[model samples]
Target chain A: MTIATATMTSKQRMLAALDGRLPDRLPVTTHHLMPYFLDKYMNGITDQAFFDYFDMDAYVWTVPHRHDPSQGEYPDPEQGEIGFLESRRVSTDDWRVYWEKLPGYEYQTVRYRFVTPKGTLSMVIQSNEHTAWVAEYLIKNKRDIDLLGEYMTAPKCDVEAVNRTAEEFGERGLVRGHICCFDVFGQPGCWQDAACLMKVEDLIYATYDDPEWVHELLKILQRRKMIYIQSLQGARFDIHELGGGSASSTVISPKIFEKFVAPYDKELIAAAHHAGQRITYHTCGGMMPLLELIADMGPDAMETFTPPGMGADVNLAEAKRRIGDRVCMIGGFDQFHYLIDCAPEDTRAEVRRCFEEAGANGRYILSPSDHFFDADPELIRAFADEARRCSYR
Target chain B: MTDLEDLRQSIIEGDMKSTTSLVESALADGLEPGTILNDGMIAAMTEVGRRFEEGEYFVPEMLIAARAMQAGLKILKPKLVDSGTKPLGTVAIGTVKGDLHDIGKSLVAMMLEGAGFEIMDLGVDVPPEKFVEAIRGGAQVIAMSALLTTTMPNMRATVEAVKQAGLRDQSVIVIGGAPVTQAYANEIGADAYAPDASAAVRVTRSLIS
Candidate 1:
C-alpha cells in the first residue's frame, strides 16, 4: 500500500475521503456527541474541544437558515434555539406554532400545535434529561398532509451565514447540514419524515394497504424538502445527511425499502448533487442488506456501520469490499463495548481492526455507529489516540 | 379457500379486512371461538414468528400480521369469554422509567397476546413500583423495554425492585430493545433476553416451561 506523503488538517482529511481519495491518515471523528455523555463524563466540554481533547479530527456541525419574507415567511414567534438538523422555524400568518407544557407521567411532555388557515395539527413530545421522542405524531388524520402542503412554509438556506462560519472554521472541520423535514416532528428523508408524522408501522402498512396515499404523503414531504434543497445552491456544506433509522433494513424489509424509501430519497440525493452538495445517507442500524442499494442512490458517503452486538448487522470488511470503492465509509467502531467497560488494550486492538479492515483503503473514517449516552473519558482518549497513530505512512 | 384456511392466510398476509371477514364467517359457520383462535389466528402468528426468524419477513410484515391478529381477536374475544377459554399466561409489560419508546414494546405485547397471553401494558416510563404492583396483581411475566443506553439501567433497577418485593421467584423478567443484549440481561439478573419480537415468545415460553 502506498502511504500518503503529505500531512493534512482535519478538514483536508475529511474532504479527501469524501472525494474517495487517500488522506494522510485514516480520518477519525464521530457522530453527534450526546450532551448526557459530555456533561456526565467530560465535565461538559464544548463539542469542538471534545474532539481536540482526543486530538482526533473534528466535525463542525452548522446549518444556517434564513426567511423568505417575500413569501410572507418570518421566524416563528414562539420557537426557541434551533437544534441539530433543524432549520429556524419559518412561520407565516396562516401557519403558526404554539406549544404548551403538559403534565407527563414521568417526563416532561409538551404539545405543539400548528395553527393553520385550513386547520390545526398537533403533536406531543416527551423528554427527559438525556433526549426526546414524539409522544403524539402530528398527522392524526389522513388529510393532515394536505394541510401541511397548503400552509407550511419552507425554510431557506442562510448562505452568507453558513459561508461565514465555514471561512472562519477553515481547516478545522467540515461544515454539515441536512434537508428540512416535516413540521413539528420529522427526519430528513421523505419516508422517514412520514414515519415521524405518523407511525413507522402505519407507514409500512400504508405501503401495502394504501400505496397511493403513501405516495401522496411522500410527494408532499418531498416537495417541502425540495424547496430547501433549491435554496442550498451556494451553502458550503461538506455533506448533508439524509435517511433515519426508520428507513434502516433492521426496521423494514428490503421490499419496503425499495418501494417506499429508495424512490423518494434517490431523487433527493440527485437534487442535492445538482445543488452542489455532497450527501451521506445515515442508516444507524442493520445495513448489510441495503449497502448496494444505498450506493446505487448516488450518495457521496454512507455511515454508522453498526455491528451485531449493537443490535445491527454490519461486517466492516464485507461492507468495505462491496461499496468501499464507490463511496466513503464512515462509522464502524462498536463504541458501546469498546468505548467503555473494556480494557484499553482491547480498545486499541479494535481501532487497529477497523484500520486493517475498512481503513486500509483511502476513503474510510473511523467513527462510532451513533451517539453514546455514557463512556469512559480515558477509553475515548485511547480510541482517538490509537486512530491518529493509524497513519498511511 | 375454506373459512379456516382463509382466516389463517389473511392474518399471515396481514390483510386485516379479509382476516376479520373470514373470522366473522367462521363464527357464523358455528366454529368455536377457541378453535378459530388457536387453529386460525394464533396459528398464523406462529408462522409469522417462524418467517421472522428465517428472515423471510421483517418488522413491518410482523407488525402488520400482528394488527390482523388483533382485529380478528377483537371479534373472537367476546365469544372466547362466553365459552371460558383461558389465556396462556399473564404478562406485565412496560418501557421502563425515563424512556418513552413504545413501538417495539407494543409489538412484543401484541405478539405475546397473539400467542394467547393476557397482556398488562403498563405503558412507557413506568417506574419500578408499577412493575412491582403488576407482579402483585398476579402477572406471571415482566417484560421491559428501553431504547436508550441511558435508560437501560432501569431494567436492572426494575429487577431489583421485583426481588425486593419478594415477587422475583414468581415472575419471569424479560428485557429487550435496540441496545439490549443477552449479556445485559444476564448482568441485570433478568430471567431472559429476546433479540426481537419473535424471539421474545420463544424465550418467554422456555422460561415458563
Candidate 2:
C-alpha cells in the first residue's frame, strides 16, 4: 500500500484509522481534556481551542442519557459545568433520594442516600478540583444489590439530543459516548461496574467467598447494561467506550478477564454493532496479555496501551504485531514523563517510536497512554507537529 | 486428608466456610495454633503469592485466598496471643497526600497482612505527619502508594518528613504505585520500591528483617 498524497481533515483522519485505512498522516489525539488542566494550565480554554492550539485531532465526548418518563426520572437540579449528561433521579415515592454535605475536608464531600421500600443504599463521593472518587461505595451489603435491581432506572440513548450535538460538531471530530452503567457510579464492563458499586477489594474477595453470589451480582449488572445497549439503536455516535481500567491485565489476570470481563462485554459489543455504532474497549493499563481477548470482543478499536514506565507492561510494537490487524490501536505514547518533564525533541522521538511500531499498520491513532493533568504546551505542539510529519509513503 | 492438610486446601481453594470450620476443629482437637497458622494459613497464602507471581492467579484469586486466610486467622488470633505468638512485624501503609486512590495501598496492606505483618492502613489522602506519627507509634516499615503523577512528589515530602522528624533510621520507607519507580524511590530516598502487591510483601519482609 502507498501513502496518499492528499491531506485529510481531523475527522477524516480519525474515521479512516477506525475503518482500518491509512490517512494522509497519523491521527494524533489525547485521551481526555481534563477540566482542571484547562482551568489551571491553559487559562480555561475550551476543548476545541486546546486541540486547535496543539493542532491535534479532537474527540468530542457528549453523553446524552434518556430516562423513562413512566419511571419518574428527572434531571438533576444541581448539575455543574463539568457534568455532561449528569445522572437523573429515578426514585419516586417508593424510593426517595436524599443528600448531605459532610463537614471538614480539603475537597467537597457529598453523601447521597437512596431510600427504597426494601432498604436504603448510600454512596459518598469526594471531589477536588481534579476529579471525584467514591469514598464509600453504593452497595454496602448484598441486599443492596437487590434494591438496585428493583429501584434503579435504566438509561437509554437520547437519539435526538446526540444527533443535535453531532450536527453542531459537524466535521470537526468524532462524537464519542459510553454504554450506560449504574447511576452515579458505574463502569462499562459488568464486573467492573460491580466493582464500583462494591469496592474493588470487597468485590474481589466476594468472588472467592461467595462465587455464586458474585456471578449473580454480575448477571444483574449485565442485564441493566443490556437494556441500555438495546436502547442505543440509531444513535449517531462515532464510537462508544465499553471497558474500564479494571479489565486491564495490570489489575486482573487474563484468566479473570476471560471468565468475568470478556463474555458480558462481547455481548455488549454485538449489541452495539447491531445498533450501528462502533465500540472501543478502553483499558487504561496493561494490554499485553489480554490483547487477543479484547480484540475478540469485537470492538472497532483498543486504547491506552500503557507503557512499562507507567507501571504497566505494554509493548506497542508487540501489541501491533499481535492484534493491530484485528483492531485499531489507539494509545502508547508515555505522557506521564515525556509529555511533562522531557525536552521537545525527546517528545518527538517518542511520537516517532509509536508511529514506527503501531502506525505501520493503517489502523493506529497516536494518543497519550491516558489522561495527563500536566504537560508542557510546547511539548504538545512538538508532538502534533511530529505526528503530522509522519506521513505514509 | 489430615485436618491440617484439609485446612490448607480450604484456604487455598478460597472456601472461607470450610477454612474457618477446619481451624476451629483443629483447635478443638488440641492442635497447636502456631502449627495450624504456619502450616495452614500462611502456607496457603505463600502458595497464592507464588501463583500470583507465576501468573497462574490474579488479583481476584489472591484477594479471595487472603479473605479465606483472614477468616481462619480470626479464629486463631486469640489462641496465638495466649500461646505467646507475635506477628512478623508492623507496617504502616497509606496513599500519600492529595491522592485519593487506595486500591494499590489496600492491596499492599492485605498482602502484608497475609504475610503475617500487622498493617496500620492510614486510608487515602494521608499527610506526611501521618507517616511520622505511624513511625513514632512503633511502625517499623512505612509503605506509601500514589496512583497519580502529580501526587508523586508527596512521597519525597513524606521521606523528608521522616528524616526531619529523626525517624528515618527507625523506619524503613517503601513506595509503590502506577507512576512510582525504583529510580523515583531512590530519588525520594525511599528504602525500597515494590512493583506490585506481592513484591510489596516480599520487600516489607526483607525491610523488617
Candidate 3:
C-alpha cells in the first residue's frame, strides 16, 4: 500500500480505480439511489445532495434516445419529466400505449401494444412508487415474436443531448448508461432479453422444444442492440452498463450462461471498446461460478458482487484473488444486515472487512450488493465515513 | 429398457413428447397408475433435483423436466383418479401482498407439485385474508413468498392472521424468497424457511409428515 501526498477528486479516484491504479483513498459508492429511500429517509434530497452529504464519490446516469421520423417514430405522449431515469421514449405509430387501474391493486397497470401488419403483440406493466415490473409478458404467443421483429422501432443514441448533459455535469461524477434493451422490460444480454419478452420458464422449455426459434429470437434482439451500439460511437460515457440480474448464476445455470449470455455480451463489449466506451457487467446476484467467464467478456468492470448473507454466494476475498487482476470489482458490502438496525460501529467494521478483502488490490469499489429500498440514514453516513478512513498507506 | 425406465429417462432428458407417449403406452400395457407415477415421473424429478443441487442442472433444465413431468401426469391423471389415488399433501402458496414478483413463488409451487403435493396457487400480491381462506379451504400448509424486503412484513402479518383465525395448529406456515432467510423466518414466527425451490419441497414435506 502506498500513501498519497495529495488528495484526489471523486472523479479522479474512480477513474484511477477503473484504470487499475491506486488513488489517494479507497473509492466508495452506492449502487443506486432509490426514490423510496430518498423520500422516506433522506427528506427527498437529490442524488447529488445525498452524495455530497455522505462525502462519497457520485454517479450521474443519462440515456438520450433519438427517433427516426422517416420510420414514423415519435416521442411518447405520456412520457413524464423523469422518464425511466433520464431516458427519452421513442415509438412508431404502430406502437400504442394504454393504462388501467385495477379495483384493488395499489399500482397502475399499463399496456404497451405493438401493432404490425402481420400481427399484434402487447406487454402489461405495473408501476408503483419505487419501480415497475412486467405483469403480462410481451410475447404471449409464438407468432408475436415475428410481429416484434418486423414493427418494433429501433432507437438511436442522441449524441448531441448526451454531450450537452456531459458538459453540464462536468467533473461532478461518472456518466453511466446501459446498452439498449427491449422497451418496458428487457435485459442487455440477448437470451435474457428474450426471456423477458417470452417468460423465462417458457423460453427455457423452448430451448428443448424449439431450439431454432430460441436462437432466432436471440438473433433478432442482438441485432437491435448492435444498432444501438453503432450509434454510441461519439458518446462521452465513462462506463456503460450491460447484463442484468437475470443473467446471474442465482437465476440461471453456468451452462445456460455460456451458451446464451457470453456470446452476445462478449461481442457487445468488444464493440463498446471500439466505440471508446467502458463496460460494466452488472450481475446483482451469485457470481462466484461465472467470475472467470464474465472476465473473459473483457468488460472493464463487474458490479453488484452480492455477499453470501444476502442470498448470494460471493466471497469477496476469494473473488478478488481469482479475477481481481483482470477487471475492476465493485460491491460486496451486506447492506441488508449491516446498513440498518445494527450498531454504527458494526457497520464500520463491515466496511473495514470489505476493504481488507476486496480493496487490497487498488481496483475495488465498496458498494452495497444491490439497491435497498429502506435504510438508516445514520448508518449510511457511517458507511461513508468509515470508508474514508480506509486509506491505503 | 423397461417401459418405466424409458419413461424416467425421457423425463430426465426433458423430452416431453416422448415422456407423454411413453406414459400412454405404459397405460395401454395395463401398468398400475401409481407405479407409473412413482417409478417414472417422481423418480425423474428426484434426479432433476439432485442434478440441480450438484450444479449440473439449472432453472431452465428444471423447468423443462417439470414440463415433461406435467405432460406425463396429464396422461396419468384420469387413471390415477379411477384408482382413487391421492396426493401426499396439500399446500397453498402465494407471493405476499405489495410484492408482485411471482417467478420465485411459481417455481416453488411447481417444485412442490412435482414432489407430489397438491398446490393451490393464490398468485402474486396475495393478502393475509387469502391465506386464511386457503387454510379454511383445507390447505395443510401455507407457503408465502416475498421478493422484496419491503413486502416481508406481510409474511408476519399472514402468520398473525392465521393465529387470529384460530387456524395456526391446523396449518404450517412456510416463507421464502430472495431476501428471506431462516433468521427472518424465525423472527416472524414462521414454521420454516426455504432458500430455494428444491428446499421448499423438502421443508414442506417434513412439516406435513
Identify the candidate with maximal lDDT: 1
What digit string (tens of lDDT, one per residue) describes model 3 on residues A1-27? 233443887888888889898877888
lDDT of each residue in B167-191, candidate 2, tens digit only: 8999999899989999999888999
**TM-score: model 1 vs. ground truth:** 0.96
Query: Which candidate, 1 or 2, has the higher lDDT?
Result: 1
Clashing residue pairs, backbone N/CA/C < 3 A, model 1? none
Q: For candidate 2 chain A, which ten residues in a row score worst on lDDT?
A: A76-85
Task: Evaluate model 1 with DockQ and give the value.
Answer: 0.73
RMSD (Å) per prediction: 2.1, 2.7, 2.3
- Model 1 agreement with the true structure over B47-162: per-residue lDDT tens digits: 99999889898888898999999998999999999999988889999999888778889999999999989999999889999999999998999999988788899999999999
DockQ, structure candidate 3:
0.63
Q: Rank the candidates by DockQ, best first.
A: 1, 2, 3
- Worst lDDT run of 10 residues, candidate 2 chain B, spans B1-10
TM-score for predicted model 2 compared with the true structure? 0.93
lDDT of each: 0.88, 0.84, 0.84
